[model samples]
Target chain A: MTRTFKIFAKELRDYFVSPIAYIVICIFLLITGWFFFSTFFIYNQANLRTFFTLLPVVFSFVIPAVTMRLFAEELHSGSYEMLLTLPVKLSDVVVGKFLAGAAFASLMLVPTLSYAVSISFIGDLDWGPVAGGYLGAVLLGAAYSAVGVFASSLTRNQIVAFITGMVICFSLTLFDKIAIFFPAAIVGVFTQIAAGYHFENISKGILDTRDVLYFFSVIFVFLYGAHLVMQEKR
Target chain B: MIHVEKLTKFYGSFCAVDQIDLDVSRGEITGLLGPNGAGKTTTLRMLTGYLAPTSGTIRINDLSIDDDALAVKKLIGYLPESAPLYHNMLVYDYLDYVAGIRGMQSRRKAERIHELADLCGLSGIMHKTVGELSKGLKQRVGLAHAMMEDPQILILDEPTSGLDPNQIVEIRDIIRRIGREKTVILSTHILSEAEAACDRIVIIDKGRIAADGSTESLKQGSGGEHTIHLSLLGADFEEASRAIGAIDGVSRVERVEGANVDELRLRIFAGGPDRLREKIYACVKATDWIMVELTQEGKSLEKIFRDLTREV
Candidate 1:
């Protein structure tokens, strides 16, 4: 919708004009890029498997830090009330901020492309798995950002939002690995719902519509929850 | 035009706004005056469709807030107590974004932005980021954004709350100018501001209407009775009090200090000021006192406000 795009464009512009977005982006690249080089040199491998494996763990903290202030800052500064009074719908505001966080996450992935390009020079690189890994990382980042936004809606403090989002994302990421100690029947169901299960399949060049649907559904559920939170605030 | 009937909002078990009725006609400026937590903001939010009323109906130009929220919102521009703004955004860009969301065409957006910027005194700060601007400038920018679409109604909640005296005057002038063409509901605790800007004042106390009328009418309604100040020379204080209190329409008489020892001052509570001087002079002539000066003490708006809100 035109209204959604208008909100999206403004949100994106706000990110660039302020130091918060740039600071988060710079730190994300610096830390991730360090791990990328360190893993490649230590392993002496031409593949990006190490980088892909470590991304979810690193993003569990960084993505929430990036998305924590999306709605929380707006509410704290009284801008949420202003936005609610406008002609736009609540869905537009939720989707706009979600897309803004997704766009920032996408930018974080753009710099990692050079890692793919660098590995190509060192040795023979299978672009198939590497491309799939990047796709998986981006989708994972999208889902994480949505959850972060939902947490941000629950409170007006950015720190609380960040911690809450990180906890939720970390729980979802580690739930499957932890469930293995339990009974097999319980573990199977938990793993199916775990973020790592779907991400691992996509990282290995497996294009499962079910996995994509799962990621989208996760994004939708959190975003819808954020919408509900905002409506309750009104 | 706006019509609100039996509007109520509850936060769980606590009622923020009770059942209230009001009508705002086109091109009329109405003032909503109340203390903090008196539900002025909540009521305004409901009118703007930002908050749903617990029970009631709000019809703006005959469009219900529930059924036609978007349509109703499009016809209203609201400025909350704290003008919501993106601090990182340039004024022009922010207004442009609002214009786009309000469905203005790109071609006409520039012209509308320019017009609003000029009207709100924000043309000089069009390129500056909002965070870098002063509070008054930021408020001006908010005003610019609210007027970008030129809606038929403007709802301003304490638009001049934190501004300096000069800024307050400037904002009041702008509001008065805009109110000529647009129906406006200006909310404030400043009675003088309402008296200066609004055609009618709706005073809400404890989630209910305490008084609703023109400034003069409300003052008269709450004044109770008139008072006359009398200064007399060579008069017996007790005898003068008794004589003045005996006059028809005069309720009570109380003694007050004069500038000199020989001078005696008395305040007379009466029906009105008419013929009070004659009655006083006649009463003083019969006695051995000289009537020095007598003047009617007009009732003030402050007294009316205090009387209306004070517990019975």
Candidate 2:
């Protein structure tokens, strides 16, 4: 666990020191803020539903950019050997990088708190949905981060990782929408596997165990996949 | 001590390292001398547990690479070929991070970092970012990082490769200092470095150990023939050659013109370390020739190395 913490701290330091983290944060905040302010008066909604509604699409692109260089750059630069030769497990590296990306993406959502606060001046704001919306945003970002990190580990090219991650996130986000085009017999499972399937429920101020479990499950699967790739490299 | 038996590594069907057996005693500087693609790096990687072998057993002290890989790794400080490093961080920050992860206490970590910084000649660049440093400086930082934990065994793959002569000497001096206290194994293709720095040399060719011995023993065993060079002012080339070649134990006599037009240089190759010089002197004295030079030279290690690793 201590070794994992050291890796985690190193990755977190890496994010702040590199320009990629700053660029991702600025782009996410600027676009999310512009969209929220542009549509706040038009929608007349006091809560963060509009922001939460736009988050899935935004993260599908932004999170990939953030996580693209996580493992790919290391592999490409031959620093993967240094990382593996350390007295640490493969899962330590995966989890540490996973958390670093997830934590960075989740922090990008924190600036939207002002949107919730500004809405309090205009109309009656429901605290439950706002809190639930932020929780849902973080969980969703963590899951996407895991997927992006796993995609990065599959290849040693940053561009390839970015494209692959965006593709996976896009398909996951809209899998439910595509289910309507498919036969009704398999629609149930297809709908269940969608990216936004459980997000809506969690964004509606409902703390359901199944929705929480789904996000965690997705996060673990991709993080474990990255770990398996690292282990195979040895 | 490290004992390796039947060590092999295969990349799919292609064998990178064939079956090899070796022993490294405690506190001895062993040089793995080989050309490129001779599996020196592969062998070192396997020894450090960075690359798993296809079929092998490496016993370092009481730990085996099979069940106690992490323990074996903990006992080793390995600098891979080219010294891969994180170029983003400052030297101090990088070493600090490594020390923390190596489980060094705060006070001891600082002291150890200071010690390595001085030993590796990195004190002046401790605050500089690794990306901004030169290649030689980067290699020094890599050495310091590998030594951060003070492991008992240090496995370095081509540590002095791609360095200038002065940098190579500095690195060699540091390795020599460290070798006194720690068991060191450094790989190099440079024959002089192995000859100058190592206590024992293990020559590897085409993934196999061609020879392993001290410099003196190797020279004596494989390069024992004595060759004497003679320069005479008046002796003719054919006459000198026939006279020296007819002597006992004198097998080959090579003649060339000396620096002077009238002088003839005869290289007398003889078996065993015998009194060929006395016989050559007597022959030159018998004739009215002026003996300008008489020198006996032993077979150089370079010649022996070529002969041993030569194609069969």
Candidate 3:
């Protein structure tokens, strides 16, 4: 467990030392800030519904960029050989890199909290859904981060990892929105598999057990998939 | 102590390492010498537990690599070829990270990092990023990384491949100092490196061990055939060959090429070692030809290596 944290700390430090982390964060804040404020006056709404709704779409692309280099860089540089030969388990490496990606994705959301605070001063902002929205955002980011790590493990090219991760995240976010094309009888299954549907339930302040369980399941399935892919490398 | 039995690895249909059995006792520097694609790197990877073998087993200090891989990893420190490290990390940060992963206490970790920096001549470059350093500096940093825990066994794959002569000598001195108390195994294609630094040399050809011995023993054991070169003025090849070929111990006589028109150069391949040089000198003294050069050359390590690994 301690070794896992060591890898996690090292990986996170690796991210901050490069310009990529700052650039990604600035772009994320720019896109989200522009989209949410573009329509805040028309709705005259006190709640942050527009901001929370666009979170999944904005994260679909941003989270993959953050996680793409976690495994791909190590493999391409041949540092994976040096890393694995250490006195640490493969699980430690998998979990460590996953946490680093998830943590960085979570950190990107910290700056967006000013949006909620600014809106609170202008109008009556209900704190319940605001709290739930932030919770659901974190869970969603973690799930996408897991998918991105799994994609990164499949190849040594960072660009390929990013594209593959973006494709998977885009499909998960678009599943419920595209369910109208499916037959009526199986529409429920598509909705259940979609990440946006559960995130919507949490952002509405419903706090359903099923929604939380869905996010946890996504995190587990993708992390386990990443673990399997890494094991096959040996 | 390390023992390996029938260690074989196959990449699809091609075998990279074939049924290699080896043993290394304590405080021994064993050099794995081979040509390119002779499975030296593959063997080192398997020994370090980075790659699982296709067949066979490895035992280090009575612990099986298959059953106790983490335990074995704790005992061995491995430096892969070219020293692939995090390019963005500073030298101090990289060594610190390795020490953290190796389970060194924070206080001791700082102390050990400084010690290794001094030992590997890395104290001056501790603030520099790894990517900006020269190849020799990066290799020294890698040595410090591998020696962070003072492991019982050290494995290096082509440790001095891309360094200048001075850097190569410095690294060799470091390795020799470490080999005094630990078990050291290094692989190299440079024949002189193996002869200079190793206590035992194991030559591999086409995924198999062709010869294993000390440098002197290998030179003496490989046929013991020495050559005598004779450069004569005012003597033709025919005359020199007739005079030197009649000696009892001389096996064959051939004229060396590219001599002056009036000079005759003859090479005599002699064996059996019955004072053949004195007899040749006496015959030269008796003849009217002026002997310009007469020298005997012993079998060299390069000759033995070529004889063993030459393609059929």
Candidate 4:
């Protein structure tokens, strides 16, 4: 466990020391802020429904950009051999990198909280759903972060990893919308597998065990996929 | 102590390391010498637990790598070719990160880093990012990283490759210094490097152990094929080749290329005993040719290496 933390600390420090973390956060905030305020007065509903609605789409792109270099850079640099030859296990490497990506993805949500604080001052804002929205955002970020890490492990090119991660996350976000094209029997299955659907449930102050379980399962499946990819590399 | 038995590796259908057995005792600097693409790196990779062997077992201090990989890894420090490190990390941070991963305490990590900085001459570049440093300096940082935990075994693949002469000497000095108490295994194609730094040389070729012995023993074991260089002032290549080729136990006589145009040089491949030189001198004395130089060349490691690795 300590070994895993050491790798986590090193990866996190790498994110901060390089310009990648800052650049990714800047782009994430700009897109989220622009989309949220542009539609804010149009609704004038005292709630952050527009921001929550666009969060998954924005995160689908932003989280992959944040996690693209996790495994790809190491593999490209040949530092992966050095890292693996050390007294560390494959689980330690996978989990440590996953946590670092998850942590950075969640950190991207910190600046958006001002949207909630500012909304409360202007109108009578219900803090319940706003707080729940933040919780759902974190879970959604982590789930996508896992997907990003897995994608990064599959290739040595960072651009390829980014595109692959984005494609997977984008499909998950758009699954429910595409469910309308399918038959009624499978439409329910598509909706159940859609990440945006579960994220919407948590954002609306409905803390369903099923929704939380869905996000956890996504995180688990992708993280385990990353572990399997790394194992195949060995 | 390290023991390897019938270790082999196959990348797809191509075998990189064949079934080879080796045993390394403590406090011995063993040099894995071979020509390029001779499976030296693949063997080192398997021994360091970077690549899983197809069919064999590795035991270090009674711990099998398959059963206790982390435990075996803790005892070994490996430096891959060219020292591929994180190019964006500062020297200090990289060392500290390595020390942290090695499970050193905070205070001890600081002390060890300081010691390695001075030992590897890295104090001047502690603040510099690794990518900005030159190859020699980067290699020094790699040395410090490999020695971060002071493991019992050090496996270096082409440690001094692509360095200037002075940097090669410096790195070899550090390697020799560390080899006094620890088991050091370094691979190189340069024979002089193995001759200088290693107590035992294991020559590998075609994924097999071609020869294994000390430097002197390897030279002695190489078949006695010595060359005698003869420079004559009044002689021609044809006459020298005919006269020397007729002698018993003289395998071949060839003209030697010489910078001095005034003298004709001939090299006699004497496969006979040590007294072949006297017989050659007698034959030259019988003639009126002036012998400017007549010297026998000693058996070199390069010759033995070529003889072993050359294809039939």
Candidate 5:
């Protein structure tokens, strides 16, 4: 457990010291910030529905970009062997890197909180939906980051990692909307697996246990797969 | 202490490391010498608990690598052939991170980092990012990171692979100094480097142990035949050669041209050089002619290594 935290701290420091993390955060903020305010003026509403709705779509690209180098670059640069030779467990390394990506994604969401503050100032806003929306967005980002980390573990090239992660995340996110064209029987099963289905439930101020479990299960499945990939390299 | 019992590793159908049994006592510097693709790196990885052996057992400090992996890992510090490092991090920061992962607290981590930096001559470049450092400095930082934990066992693969001459010397010195307190297993293709730094050497060829012994023992064991270079100053070169040939252990003596006319070089094939040397001295002393030079050349490490590892 202590080793996990130690790895987590170093990974976080690695993100801060390198330009890749900052570039990712800056791009995410610029694009998401513009959409948040623009949607506010166009809709003439004080709520953050526009911000929450746009985050999952924006994060599909940004999360992969942020998390693509987590394990891929380490393997490419030979640092993966170095880390494995340490006293830390392989599971700790996977979890530590996952937490680091999650933490960075959380930080990127911090700036969007000001949008909530701005919304509260202008009109009567129900804080319940806003709070739930942020929670849902954070969880959605975490799931995408987990998928990105797994993709990163698949290849040494960071660009390939990014493309693979984006493709996987985009497919999972858009799977529900695409199900509308299919029959009702298949649509029910597809919507349950789609990230958008669970995220939309939480965005509407519903903290369903099923939705929480769905997000956690997705994170677990991808993280477990990442662990398997690393073990295979050994 | 380290022990391996029939350790073998296979990558799919290809066997990278064959069944190999070896051991290293505490505080001894053991050298694993082999040609490229001879499984030196794979053996080191298995010993370090980085790769699981296919059908064998490895125990470090009485702990099995498979069962007690974390404990085994904590006892050994490994430096791979490629000095894997976070290039974006400063030397000190990277060492600190390693120390932290190795379970060192703040005060001890700081003290250990300083000690390792001083030991590896990384004090001057502590603040520089590893990416900005030269190859030598990067190698030193890798050594420093490996030493941060002050592990009981050290496994270094090609520690001086890409360093300059002076840097190699510095790294060898560091290894020698550290070997006094820690059990070290270093692999290198440089024969002289192994001869200078290792207390015992295990030469591997084609994924098998070719030779394993002390350097002196290997030299003496392989030094059966002796080459005697004689410089004759007067007449009776033929008589001198016959007298020397009658020695007890002398199997055959062949004469080759010397650089000067007064010199005659004899390549002596003997059961042992020690027995033949005395007869040559006696024969030369009996002759009334002056003997300019009589030198017995010892077999070089290269010759011994080649003799052991040559493809049959």
Candidate 6:
């Protein structure tokens, strides 16, 4: 566990040293901030429900960009050889990189707390849904980044990683809706696996174990897949 | 100390490393000499636990590589070829990250980083990003990375593959210095590199050991044959080669080209260690030839390597 944290720290520091982290943070804030204000002008509501809605689309792009270089560049640069030879488990490297991407996503969401603050000043506001929306934001980030890390592990090209991550996340985000076109029996099954279904349940200002576990499951499955890919290299 | 028994690795149906056995004692620099695609890297990778062998037992001081992998890995410091590193990181930051992973306390890590900085001659460029440094500096940083934990065994894969002559000398000097305390296993295709640095040499060809011994012993073992080089001025290349081949002790004669056009240099391979100078001089006296140079050449390590691995 401690070794995992050490790798986590190194990857986080790598993001800061390179321009990727800054560019990712900038793009994330820019698109989300534009959507929040544009929605606030038309609805004039104290709630940030629409603001939370725009985030999935923004994160679908930002999260992949953040995680694209994680494993892909390591493999391409041959640093995977160096990392594996260390006295650390493959799980450590996978979890460490996953946490780094999730942490960056959470940090990228920190500035958007101003949306909650500004909404509070404008009119009567319910803190429950606003706080729940941010919690949901983090959960969504963790899930998206997991898929991103897994996609990055599948190839050595960052562009391929990014595109693959986008496709997977988009499918997961819209699968349940697309399933409406399928037979009624399988619709429930697709609804259960779609990320939007769980994000919707959490965005309702409730702390439900089912919704939290759903997100955790998504994070686990992808991270475990990434771990298997790394082991195959060994 | 390390013991490997019948280590084998196959990529699908193709055998990259056949069943092979080796023993390495403490404090000896052993070089795995082989041409490319000869399973040198594959062998080292399995030993370091970077790649799992298809079938084998690798025991380091009685602990198998599979059972106690983390423990075995802790005892090994490997520097892969090309020295892959995080180019975005400063030299100090990268070393610090490596130290952190090794579980060193921060204060001790700082002190040890400084020690490695001095040892690797990386004092001045510690703050520079790794991407900005030259190939030599990157290799030095990689050396420092592998030495961070001060492991008992050091594995280097082609440590001086891409360096100029001067850089090669510097890296080889560091390897020699490190070999005094740690058991080192380095792989190289450069024949002279193995001859110059290794205490023992294991020449691998086509995934098997072709020869294993110290430089002197290999020379002596293959040195049973003698070579007599004669530079003749008045003899034709074909006539001199045929005449030398006809000598009693001479097994084969090769005309050494790339010399002065008017002169022909003949390297005659003899059957035994006996001096072929007199026989060659007699043969020359029987012919209308001027013997400008006649010197008995000792068998070099290059010759020994060729003799051992030529068929492979």
Error of 1 at A108 (Å): 0.7
Please give, for residues A1-234, the per-residue lDDT of candidate 1 as tens digits. 898888877777677777877888788878878887876777887888878877888889988988898899998999888787789899998999899888888888887888889889879999999989989998999999999999999999999999999999998788787996889878888888889888888999999999999899999999999999988877
Q: After the best TM-score superposition of candidate 3, give how far the Cα of residue A99 lies from its true spot, in angstroms.
A: 0.6
Give the least accurate 10-residue stretch of model 1 chain A, judged by summed lDDT: A9-18
Between candidates 2 and 6, name the one with more favorable DockQ. 6
Model 4, A82-107: lDDT tens digits are 88888999889989999999899888
lDDT of 3 by residue, B1-312 (tens): 899999999988999999999999999999999999999999999999988899999999999987898899999999999999999999999999999999989999999999998899998999999999999999999899889899999999999999999999999999999999999999999999998899999999888999998887888788667988888888877777887888888999998886478888888999867588899999999989998998987688788889889999
Q: Sorted on DockQ, highest at the top, how do the candidates line up?
A: 5, 3, 1, 4, 6, 2
Model 2: docking quality category: medium
> What is the DockQ score of candidate 5, to 2 decimals?
0.86
The CA lDDT of each predicted structure is: 0.87, 0.86, 0.93, 0.92, 0.87, 0.90
| Global fold similarity of model 5 (TM-score) | 0.95
Report the CA-based lDDT of candidate 1 relative to the real structure: 0.87
**Residue A141 in model 5: lDDT:** 85
TM-score of the second chain in each model?
A: 0.85, 0.90, 0.88, 0.86, 0.92, 0.83
Best by lDDT: 3
Residue B227 of model 1, lDDT score: 84
Ranking by TM-score: 5, 2, 3, 4, 1, 6
- List candidate 3 segments past 4 Å from native: B229-243, B254-266, B272-296
Predicted model with the maximum TM-score: 5
Question: Which 10 consecutive positions of candidate 5 chain A have the poorest summed lDDT?
Answer: A32-41
True contacts kept of 4: 0.75
TM-score of each: 0.92, 0.94, 0.93, 0.92, 0.95, 0.90
- By TM-score, the better pick of 3 and 5 is 5
lDDT score, candidate 6: 0.90
lDDT of 2 at A115: 82
